[model samples]
Target: MRGPHNIIRLIRTGATLERTGAMKVILDAYEAPRLLRMVVRGVVWPFQWLGMKGDTSMPPATRALTALGPAYIKFGQVLSTRPDVVGDELAVQLRVLQDKLPPFPIDVAKDSVRDALDVQVRDVFDEFSEPVAAASIAQVHKARLKETGEEVAVKVLRPGIEKAFQRDVDAFYFAADVIEFLSPASRRLRPRDVIAHFEGVVKGELDLRLESASASEFAANTVGDEGFRLPDVKWAYSGRRVMTMGWAEGVPLGDNDALDAAGHDRTRLGERVLQLFLSHALRDGFFHADMHQGNLKVAANGDIIAYDFGIMGYIDEYTRRVYAEILFGFIQRDYKRVAEVHFEAGYVPADRDVDEFARALRAVGEPIFGMDASHISMGRLLSYLFEVTERFGMETRTELILLQRTMVVVEGVARSLSPQLNIWDVAHPIVEDYIKTSIGPRAVLRDLAKTAAVMARFGPRLPGLVEAALIRQSEIEAPHNRGGHRKMWALMFLGGLVAGSGAVALAVVL
Candidate 1:
């Protein structure tokens, strides 16, 4: 899959990292190939010795990644959460990579807004001020909309950051390709697919309109949800480069002094934060992945207002139901149910022993009993669970990793507010309620109704579907007897069987 140009580019990028001193990040023993890594370090050793290249002031691991640009900055953010791979010290330093960057010139910000909305600076905002915050991709400015005189925050992407990000993403793909080509050990991690996912997550942020839609969708999903809110996105003013949203006024979640002065109860607030995250993930199947203290604020009314929707996560309905049951099972101390959920989801291999998996889960769940928010370390639990998963041949679950990372960060945020907060007490009611609504008798009837609706629409087309398949099969067999026709006929037969079964089931149920 890789060509010579890719190999040349990788060497050049490696040189860039070496010069930046970011290459010094010590990796885990399992991260191969040792010869290649050693060759890189050896190649860069002279540069370090002569002090002729690279800035060594920062940690060796973070310096090079910081030099790479936004995509790699995101990689640093992820690495910060994976202490087992990068080591604790390096992970701590990598925290700075979480959207910490200098703001681009204010003139550039104005130009971006003007171009995106096709309006003059004064035409839209009555009072555009300096950027209050800046990150790897964009900077935020507080302004008053000219039409309504309403305060809103405007986010503008940096002028040339897009090109830099694209180049870095190409570099990532090149690296992934080389790894897959050279190292069999890395295939388990699925490096290329992982980079492809990273590509999506990073590039998605470039379009502010998409972010607005996501925020709107998230808000809709959390409608009637207590203690949390999302700012209304002003589509009229929002565009690819710029987004306008109602200004959220609140104390940062991490600001204890301000939180106390504002007459907010940290203990209760902490419980609300954790509850909101869990409910969004399991009940709604969507959530704000970047829940750092900076993105979360406690409003004067004690409502939590979330901002910065560029980075979001989602799961399907099936996964959502499974996640809910797993949490509920943990609450009920039913380890078998937790294990069953994993097996049913195919996260664990079917060949694995369910009882052994249950026992392993029990070991993880039992230790956290009676633990408060501070005492219950979700990260440690996940780490132990990961260890157990490896024994059972569980593959790397990329989607769930984002959820796990966010949960760990959120629990830390919650614990900071209420050291003695009983997470189990807060989570139990929510999980139990969701499971009840989504499982058992109510769930079966709901599923049947959905199935009937699907059949109602699809049943009429069954004959045509089969007929088309048969025609395709005949054409294929007449031309090329390459045995490809079997699939076409097999698909046709399956379609007919499904159509018949669905009609029969619907009639019997009615």
Candidate 2:
């Protein structure tokens, strides 16, 4: 089923693009190579009749992607933030896919709610209005709780969305296989691993219960963060296919006119958005991965309210330190330190020359430093950074994909609010502060404290463990060797203890 169906799906995907007249438009926007464009056109053109004829009213690219399914729409949403990659005109057209997709019927949504919660809409809500917002995976209905009489947003999964996403993802897996098999150079990017990561994220999104938990955790993490908040998740009303949260009332962050009408300071809002994202990423190690305009809103008091917690990004403490240091290095224009950090983190191959990599990194960081806020493009910088890393034989770090993508999207959102927003200026204090806290003497003491706690827990059992180890070693040796083995083991244990103490002392000195 996968082989035949995936081939058909791939052909139909191309055919749909061709039939909707988007094939050329997309290629031109991406500036695809002449030979590659010709090859793509040749491949998809012949199967035009097999494709779905998307709505003729919308733009070609939008229509084709909408007709494709959820996965394609999600891809379009990501591209909408990258006007530098897809071009402004096409990016504008694709932004409509963010939260403007046609929603499923109210009856279907009600049935889904009922199925998920084992209760009728009337049983839980005093009034469940028609969907107020809709996107690829889910739709939200404005509802009032019957018991509390409080307004809440009820999010319901689109009917059959799981199967649709699974189908498209299967096709994507097949396409990745084909690409890797035909083009060995593409293997470094690990196309299959990319799809697998996408699949894992999407699967988590498909279950509303996970989204509920994510929202809860995010709310807890962001507590007391100034001018930023997440809607409170209504746990009792949440289920696998349905989630409810306190309604967020505000103007959409994308509507500049509305924001201006509300008298919000656009420049301050922009800086706050960027600063908040950095704070969350560096300090909390968890953030709203989808920070695009559609998922963000501006309250009247200028608080940046984020919802749609289906996708969140998390890195461990060590990765967070690495990320903070990289940002700090770039801000200081110390390309050599940046290159060293990459190698230290094993991001670049050990065999690569550190000096040469530093030179390449300088080529990337230097050009963007002196540019005006409006002139600098984070998206372009990231694209160039990718090229440099690839040349240096750095493999794609799957864990960082969400963080990087969210950064680009958050930058776009901030720029929309303030065209002259200086990203580096806003990010500097946050990154520098994080470095001072996480990597300095305080951090060393914290690590030592944690280590001491672990050692303390195991302290009581040390003698018995050492005795058991000696007995086991003596059993493995001969009777004649017992005395010599015990003396050697005692010396080795003492040496280890001395080494451990010396290492701790060295850590303190450093």
Candidate 3:
């Protein structure tokens, strides 16, 4: 009953499993010997044609995925984030899958809005034109708010995207579950869990409401900050299927000519954008995770307006502190502190010697510090840090990965605008200010005052705490407890009995 494509995909999957050393386990877990045979037959020739003679060549995986279509492209993109699962070299290659889809048809865009919004084109917007840019899930249009005569950008969901994405996601879940069952190394990476997380992220991306909320929250976070802003959401026109935002009139940050014609200073704008993002990350603990040139615009006054808030990043107070400390340590060439912070945050394995790890970190840092400002790249620096962390068995953090990806894109855009832009110089002052306000005596006083007020409110509970402790001591001393030793012995005996029974059961049943 299998189609040619399905048969080919089966072969591709087996080839992947074989190369990754999961072939037998995959066969055992999936219980699909017949399919495995078919897979090997279907994939062998295409792979040979592609010059991937051995099981180890990931170009086979890449070619096979591309052959399988959109679903595989999405899978490749997901795998790109999981350097731990796919290995660094393969992950790097898979990064090509990001936003590689051709744009959908223009008619489909118009019909999608009409069907979703239940209105004709003229009724909704004064002028709804063609798609400006097309991406994986949707394409954007330039339009105007009908009543207000205000220009707006309308994002229309690709029709049947949910169904298409759902099919691929279901397939991904199948693959993840099978991989986790078959490979212990993959289980440590939690393949199923990673797929689930990807599912949630992509699902959230599909829901226009969540994206709007992300925009609203980010807008609020940057309200007081200067030189950077987000497009105001036109809530009345926004929904699950569509997002309408204030029409921004500005040149794309990557277009040097347009930026110059608009009277914007590329160097200054680039510096502001870099500082703004770092400030949001280090100081506010939240930031827009998708800041590529297409999603960003520069107004005549040089304010950078960030759009496409479907993806964002957040770190808690503790993560914030650790992240800042790591940056501060790297800046000062204090690899010891950086290593200690990794240990303290439980990022590096405790058994690893801190001095050894610090030495590894020094290798990543020393080169950056030695390089001229123009020669240094925050992207490359982060990439090296990831490489070092991987040596220590640190799995990628999604938020941090997203932050790094966004940084790479933003930095690239910035450099394109002004080739001489110095990211380190642009970021240093913001990082310094954030460190001062966050960890200094002034912050300590503010936190202590807040803590004192909470303690004053809980003052009456001190007597209750004493009474509870006295009652616990009385109960512990009671005779039936066997001095609290009987409970421990009983639990240990019960656990042993259960283990013994499990062993007997496994032996007898198998």
- Find the candidate with the highest TM-score and give its number: 1
Provide the lowest-lDDT 10-residue window in model 2: 77-86
Tens digit per residue, CA lDDT, model 2, 150-252: 9999999989889998888899889878766655655654667667766877899899999999888888888989999888988888899999999999999
Compare the candidates by lDDT and give the number of the best one: 2
Global fold similarity of model 3 (TM-score): 0.77
Error of 1 at 123 (Å): 1.1
Query: Model 3 off-target regions past 4 Å?
Result: 1-79, 82-121, 180-184, 392-396, 452-510
lDDT of 1 at 145: 91
RMSD in order of candidates: 4.3, 4.5, 11.2
- The global Cα lDDT (0 to 1) of model 1 is 0.78
lDDT of 3 by residue, 390-444 (tens): 8997867777766676677678777887778877778778767777877787766
All candidates: TM-score? 0.86, 0.85, 0.77
